[model samples]
Target: MHLPSRPRVATRPVQLAPRPPQLVGRDETVAELRERLLGSDVRPAVVAVHGLGGVGKTSLTLEYAYRLQQEYDLVWQLPAAEPAVLSAAFARLAALMGLRELGADAADPVDQVHAALAARTDPWLLIFDNVPEAEALLPFLPPVGPGHVLVTSRSGRWPRDQGLELPVLDLVSAARLLLSSSGQDDEVAAADVVSELGALPLALEQAAAYMSETGLALSEYLDLLHHQRAELLAQGQAWGYRERVASTWQFAFERLARTSPQAIALLRLLSCYAHEAIPSHLLLSPLERWAPRELFRADVQRRRAYGRIPGPPARLLRDVHPSVLVMMRALPRDTLRINAALTALRRHSLIGPPVDGAVTVHRLVQAVTLDQLSRRVQRRWREVAAVLVEAVLPDDPGQKARWPRYARLLPHIRTVLGPTSPGMDKTARYLGASGDYRTARSLFQEIAAALAAALGPEEGATLTARHELALWTGEAGDPTAARDQYVALLPVYERVLGPRHPHTLTTRHNLAQWTGRAGDPVAARDQYAALIPIRRWVSGPEHPDTLTTQANLAQWTGQAGDAAAARDQYATLLPVRERVLGAGHPATVTTREQLAHWTARARP
Candidate 1:
């Protein structure tokens, strides 16, 4: 099709979609896009707005183009899903620039458009919408021009610092969209709908459009959504969109299923996790106990071959289907398989790329993915997820070194295991370590009550849960309550577990510590004095708990008005702490500092 020629290049030529009248939640993004594509200098600026499908990348780009089109002499929007269609689009631009005669004789019409746009002194903007790949568009970009090129793609293959990834709308913006699009004003119901829909723009728009069309109240829509989520997601008419939310994602899911079943499996497992950051490192840690030894060695060799350091161990395939185990074994290495799976999922926008070493799957994505699975398959994946999380949790939640690991997996643990599971004991400890003492107290209280009811009050787990509850009472600034609880529980521990048992000793230590913290340092010092010899004899002087008791004894002794005795005790304790815990360890450092303080007080 031949095109009619327009005036020469100085004349303004624009081919753009109409401006989006109300682009909620993207003002900042649009401003940043304008700044990135500003034609301030002679250098050509290319920025890629990358996001998952139906995230409104096209709407954002069109908004930027239409809002700022008047500042440029030329503006064009090119459809870039195919390289051939892109060339034809550029040829049309060439004809619009009055270069039809030149393009007819030229070997490549795309080159003619690029040269004309490149040579122009006036500013121009070219938007390459829905680019499938960065490399495919490289040849079509005008070299060293005053124009800005904006490309939008679902794939995040752009150079670092040149890509802007758009996430879903925030809660407020989503509510605004729901209400304004549907012409409804029920803020409460709007919040519920947006939460259910995961703040996804396309889903929100579809839901609002459905309500507007059907004369349904927001409350009715929400209730209907709960009962018929998949149907509602699929039923919306295309309100300026060719595909509804479900079909848009279904296409990606279908494509992913055909190309990367490993990614499909990974996504399914992720669906069973809470819709929060899933710690990628924990799942892929190289030190994972259940990783096949041969695969680990092969992965190490592979890393050496690539001149890269081996990373953490990948997750185990425990209690999973036999087919999954076979699939895992067929791969070269676990890490390689996982990385490939992540890449595939990212390419299709089915999962967000890793951020802060964690990946987040949208809640709606989780809902839809789980909804599509057979009940048996969903049950199996949920079981596999629980095993994966439990296997990665460190044995000691008290170790500060493992706090980040716990933090990353805590959400998933709470999701898969529920609040009262024995697994939550570690979560309660983690909460205490993180200074959330009150929350730890409440959690332990519930856990202790539940365990006592289920397993009998004298069961070991119930006693431990009660013990944690009392400990956090002191930590939460109620040392009197802590002291009283420990006072009541110590005899029970001694009678039930025997006096020399570690649990009884631990209870004794806490009782003494809280006695001092509750303002009776003399009594606390006496209690510690009585317990230290037994602790040393039973658990050894250098056991961490024993050292902890000794340290507390010195603190209480000083507080009980015996600075000289405290000085001598800390001096004696310092060397043991240094030798056993290391000189730079925080506990040893505290001992040294304490010895200096008490020595000064005693001398004066």
Candidate 2:
């Protein structure tokens, strides 16, 4: 049967275009924000841009703020900080707009900020940057009016309709941005760079900036980037930025360690999975180990004091902070520590609030997080291979008899073991020797060259593998190839086990059968004649193998048209078979029947 080719998985990272200088690739988002700001239809009091950090939320809001500047008599950009600092900043905004406050604490600063916006008849625009919490800012947000308020945040609680989610740039926009930033006029090279960088605006920007600083061509920069992405992302000093991508992550990592140390460890643990998405339950094991009973009790007490939970179940103990979730989503693949990393993702709800028994992490995030996993976390990757091998092994009679199920999971087994694993070689031999000859043949050939290099030309295992390879080749309809393989193995077996050894005898017997199939009956007769005396010597006349070899020689003699010789041989073996076993025994009955048939044929 012809097997279909396995599908190849695309390993390249997805690329998105860079935001334009004025506006990136979010035309629809900008349009939606504009309509809500200017349109008379139930004008929302607040317009928000909500997403993960570095997703261009600030850029989108800034672009919209500039666009609506003419419509509003006053436009103010507010920096989000503590509530007290925000109130003070609002007071300063009132002073800048030339408003006199009657009392400092007539009401809360939130109420005061709202009153100030309400007092304005002229249309106004307020751009609030870096609002971390929706609840804290809710009191400060003014009621809906002709004026517009635009806010940017990393929080998930912002109103969805009014919120603009900034996804990464598409390929075309990303390519253009790389070309423009690197000052490269060649479209072809720029496109190549963008594709290689996965079209993420941040990655593209870093690549472009790297090229600009080093004065290297796009292709040369890409080669460097391919070899040294982690190194390049670590170079914040060269770029004059407070943090390069790597450092920004490290800052987040440090914060997580301080705030929620368990979650940080969980992030490292999750880095082990290879799948695009992993079930959330995989995190539970590490968390259970990391957070002990006494410490968990203390955490429950703290949450209870804070009124965070009404009851203390194990689930309550597992709740991860929102900030940690953001960090897990943002983590680069190579740097993620799998066991800790996945646990962190579960805690953060980045992957799941696992319903039932399963949850799936985003493939891209999972990949990036896995890339970040440390060597210690890599033990889990090895465990995963062992898990797959066990899961796919034929465990029942039906499974052993049915070849398709075993065939289907073979690739998964191969993938789990990886190409270079020592387990792969052992698995190949075990399957081949265990009667899954077809699969064994392919696996043997695949690893043979490597094994040859490592174990040398005349190794015992290599010779055995070649013998099996030949046997399967004959089964697969290549008798000549099988005959050649048997010939190759014959000398090796004789040298290793001696000519009269049982294994060597078996090899000779197989070679004779291949000789007959290859249309050389004379060679087959010679082999059978040699095996008959050897088998008789090894086990005497009563041995089943000796009798079987005699019977085989008799049948070949009959086929070669020597009926009298064949009858004589059959008559000699008949008493040995009858004396060794009962009449109903399968071998005894079969030999008696063969004698009758040869006797009848001779008479005719």
Best by lDDT: 1
lDDT of 1 by residue, 307-343 (tens): 2222333432232356544433332236667788888
For model 2, residues 150-226, the per-residue Cα lDDT tens digits are 77765545555566555557878878777877789778877877665546555666666777777888877767656
lDDT score of residue 373 within candidate 2: 60
Model 1 ranges with Cα > 4 A deviation: 1-14, 40-44, 72-74, 83-124, 139-146, 188-196, 214-231, 286-289, 292-337, 351-356, 418-423, 449-457, 477-604
TM-scores vs. true structure, each candidate: 0.71, 0.54
Q: Assess the local accuracy of residue 195 in candidate 2 as a C-alpha lDDT between 0 and 100.
A: 63
Worst 10 residues of 1 by lDDT: 1-10
Alpha-carbon lDDT of model 2: 0.58
Best by TM-score: 1
